[model samples]
Target: MNTLKRTLALVATLAMTATAFASCGDEKKESTPKEEPTTTATPEDTTAPEETTAEPDNGDEIDASVKTGGDTFTIAAWNHDDVPYLIAQWKGLSFDTVVEDLADNKVDGIKFIDMNVGGGQAAEKYDQLFNEGSDLDVYFCEADWALKYINDDSKTLALSKLGLGDSKFTNIYNYTDEIGKDQNGVRKGISWQAAAGGFAYRADLAEEYLGVKSPDEMDAKIGNWENFVAAAKEVSEKSSGGVALADTLGGLWQAFACGRTQPWVVDNKLVIDDFCKNFADTAKELWDCGGVTKNSQWTDEWTAAGVSGNCMGYFVSTWGFGGFFLDAAGGENGAQYGKWAVCQGPTPFYWGGTWIVVNPETDNGEEARDFIISATSDEAQMSAYAKAKPEYVNNSQVMDDLIAGDTVFNPTVSGNFKDGQNYFKKLAENAKSIDFKGLITPYDSTIKGNFADAVKENYLDGNKSWDETVEAFKDKVAESVPDLEWDD
Candidate 1:
């Protein structure tokens, strides 16, 4: 709470630094939209919220002001990835309900506005919606640009307004809780998934190159940046430079950046500490020694590197295993299938997460509250969703129970790993360890992405000096965010 208080106090000074930015710069793999589902089934009856009174988790009944039974409830998101499935789970639809069936933009009384845009572009679409006074009751927010709405009272509704309070969200992860709150420490949003990350590696490669047969051994081998570099060197030498210990510079930055102990900006000035230089130097070492592959992420070559045995590991989040990680193994029974495993990387980090925010002008506040509760608060629904969508749900208690129960979120993805490892268990450890409390800034997405780009282009790829790299990073930040005071 002290961190949140401190963060809120700094908002007045730092607010201007992000108000000019239009898009989320945090890079993420988005879900591909599908046309329709192959099978059609009737959506199950949904449970409606109680009409007059609501009891919060702390055993206090509050007078609910939000009215229910609106003619239509509208929800919006950039893509069809999450909202569809979330709706399915909330409605008690069959766990096997095909998401594509809801992609037609209609499911019962709910009218989904599929902006069909990238996460970065969703803000523009939402702006248009708000300007037109479109009927939007609930909307999703990416962690990066979430503050753009959370901080705007006119855009986001406080959960307390709907009779939901802290007690209802007591079981969620800490890092995610911080991101959903706005300046002054009011909860405006909540997420359903925890996008924690870890280093996923080829089990055979670790054993062959580093003499590490288990994830525990591999984790110890690269426990810190220093040890990680040493292990990379060992892998490079043993493999005759044919295989790299890591995947990409971008991947390395994702893990390393989270270790930052300071905000990107303070007092309207950009803060470029030793963390930046250290990352550049580390990335350069990997680039020069072939410790990491040159292939860019989200590309065919990136996935092909794994199949051809050119790359040993990838820094992956919970959502990735179901998507790109499968491709890296060349699909089920493919070349690299069943040879993979995951370990806690050099540091604890989270990649991408989506939050549910209510529109302040919404008429279906009760429905919004109920939907959020099902996705984020209610243990049973969250647990069902965790396994059904193969998601790493945001509720820590639910995830802990699932992990203890040895629940397999996805079979094909687990089967692709060595010994069919339950990868979510590793991510849960990371989810609990991530602490981005007072450290979050609205400009974080842009600054982090810009910093990563400068490091890759100037230092690692261009062979520029460290000072030159710093200058390049500064120049990029200046262009992206001109409001900050540059320390020359």
Candidate 2:
């Protein structure tokens, strides 16, 4: 059978079972406010105008040794490599040329300083830095830590005051109402880039054994959670004991759970909506089908699985395609180069991203804002950095270059670089703006650790019933947010 025919068969089987057996146990009991479905099929406009190739500006005239008013602009970031990209684009030019063009259009003497902080020590180090009155001008915060930084007020700059609260970087700020904006319409940080989630599977394996071709067809067969697991079961049966995918039940559970809800906690009562139950049951089914690895035993399994070609691709964040997945596959694994591709998962869910914020206490506030404007402008600097690094563009227009360029691979849809970009666009459309107030408390580590442990024990081990697990989750939420009130 051809890939198309097999996929059609799988879809037919799933559609038949969906009405009777696939209803999610925890879907919203109260009808979720209807919004036009965002992920429906749309016609492709593949022909876009080419981007202008302006001459590169390497900072030359301004003396590198000259100090402007004893002002040193310090930027705190987890990725230290971005500093080089900034310097390469704008180093010695006059404040007008560098700051105005690159930074937000200010002309002031400011010495650039970049700090490298590891991701593991993010919150602790940031807190210490803020408390000690470090002369930091800019900082990057992850999704979970964004609320902590914004709520503290004194630790960071109020972007509204700095004039960056209304940036025009459509992709980064495009979904502000949903992801980046606070309850009071305060824009604390701008999403600099994103790592979208999609299914990466072996095209050759699917073609030869399973018979799958186009992503649209794949969507029919394995689009949502119910169909995805059913397809995995069929793949497992066909492979005869070989792992269908390279993920553990915990990892799969997290992806599905996160995808199903607005956020993990809403109004403080651990959201036990039908989606949650559906996600848990999906994990249970995968576990029963021998489709998952244990959390403790995936390292060697992942390594061997990648090299052996027996396993199908696993769920991957967009950034992981370049950073983690490519690195693990040894960067251009000969014949495996074009064999892998991406497809939309059951639902749109974001995995990872970083937001950049300016510090209000800085003496060079104007200069800092200028720098931010230039760095984040829809111009080439931001686009180039995204291209060179394993980073996704926060600017929608930067995607033009990405789609036109040959370097970035689109594993979901073969021969279509726009595949990932389209996926993110849809995700942004469907996403509900989650309130981050109680999700990341001051004691972030403790909260995350406890939640991770509970998820592993209850879902992975199958030790607790759904009701019991939800009750435990509620207790954990109460421990974190003592004053939280649910609408009940």
Candidate 3:
């Protein structure tokens, strides 16, 4: 057989095996947690009503690779959104036990510090914890700012210390694995979900405005940036500038910025190439032509856009279908429900994702190792969590099986899409192709935010030229990150 056929056969075999394993347990689905809020102290609905006593079946024999018997396992995160649920899956405890008891810090052998802050502010809280020499074992990190801890040897411990070698995580998506590693390629962190993204457009709007009948046609219409811009213009003209093809400038940046082929900073020098100019030009055109919405992201106006039919599409990731996306559809029985479809947009990109990392001072190495295994490596546990949490889990093999087997993750969310399409399938295609091996930098979060702000204020809003916008971006970034060198 040829190489391609062999590869396909292997994947098919793995899918079948994974499906059998995934069927081993009864899946009890729960409502996904709301997206982390910037100002909220705690996550909404941190406590769940149901009790789950059954532990995930990890086959007959257990692999106790690391030493056990630590007195307490302490986990920390910015909010109660994911850590509580993840720990519940790992400890076989009720979600309520993890959330409520952990909030009071009364769980006998576990301590979960919610921090009660946003993801961006969590770094400072973590630094304070380290300063006080608090008892911290495992912690979560966001993708953009993960390098802050991963690069600090005193903050993060290598997974190898817990016997979690690359062999154990072979089935995980490559881009996630890349983010978990540090500057020297040492494996410092790992994520449980593959947060791959695609363009979810209103099928009714596409039909009315673009004359596209299906997602395939829609994707072909906006397959690349140039084509996407043209399609947006078409939508604007057809709608008489009443509707926008893209959601917001921030959303566009989320999908557009990921296509960069060079590191933002190399050898302590900032790099600004034609990619910056192209994005500015694109944003400016869309801003002027009403091809993209002017609403700032994370506002009520953004969600209202979809409900009011003012926007045609959203660049959404796997996690979004539950929270903001559902709100955008005005809930399950809302006016716009069941009118959406997803396609691998102009480019493959990922939005927000969380990573699990161990503290170098962890006294509970065994619990940390076991938790990571259950959350990330053990196919049985991950499959169960994926179904229960309804997440696009990191393991490619498990997701492949779930998608292949036509497992419906969530009925209500699926009902939000046209014909209840299997949305994970489209996200899976993008997940496999995201290449970010040498692209991550510790200053990524600050730099990306600064650039976007500069573009919005200086180029898109103020109508500045490319060079002037570049200078404004430089000045803004210099205030935040003064160490990097740049041309005047």
In model 2, which range of ten residues has the least summed lDDT?
A: 12-21
What is each predicted model's overall lDDT from 0 to 1?
A: 0.77, 0.49, 0.77
Among these predictions, the greatest TM-score belongs to: 1
Q: Taking the tens digit of each residue's C-alpha lDDT, what string does model 1 give over 1-488?
A: 12122222121212111111221111121111212212111222222221223223323332355555677999999998888889889887654553655665436788888889878778889999999998899999887788889888789877777767887888898888888888667788899998888999999989999999988898789977878989999999998999998988778877777776667766556677666676788888888889999988777998899999999999998888978888989999999999999998777778888989998788887788889889999999999888888789998899999999988778898899888787888888877887766777677888788887888888877888887886677666655655554332
Question: Cα deviation of 9 in candidate 1 (Å)?
Answer: 26
Across 381-478, the per-residue lDDT of candidate 3 in tens digits comes to 89988888778899999999999998999999999999878999988988888776777776666667778888999887887877778777766555
Clashes of each: 0, 23, 0
Arrange candidates by TM-score, highest first: which order?
A: 1, 3, 2
lDDT of 1 at 291: 97
What lDDT score is found at residue 108 in candidate 1? Answer: 76
* Model 1, TM vs. native: 0.86
**Model 1: lDDT to the true structure:** 0.77
What is the lDDT for 305 in model 2?
61
Which residue pairs collide, candidate 3? Answer: none
lDDT assessment of candidate 2: 0.49
Q: After superposition, how far is residue 387 of candidate 3 from its true place, in Å?
A: 0.6
Candidate scoring better on TM-score of 1 and 3: 1
Once fitted onto the true fold, the runs of candidate 1 whose alpha carbons sit more than 4 angstroms away are 1-69, 95-106
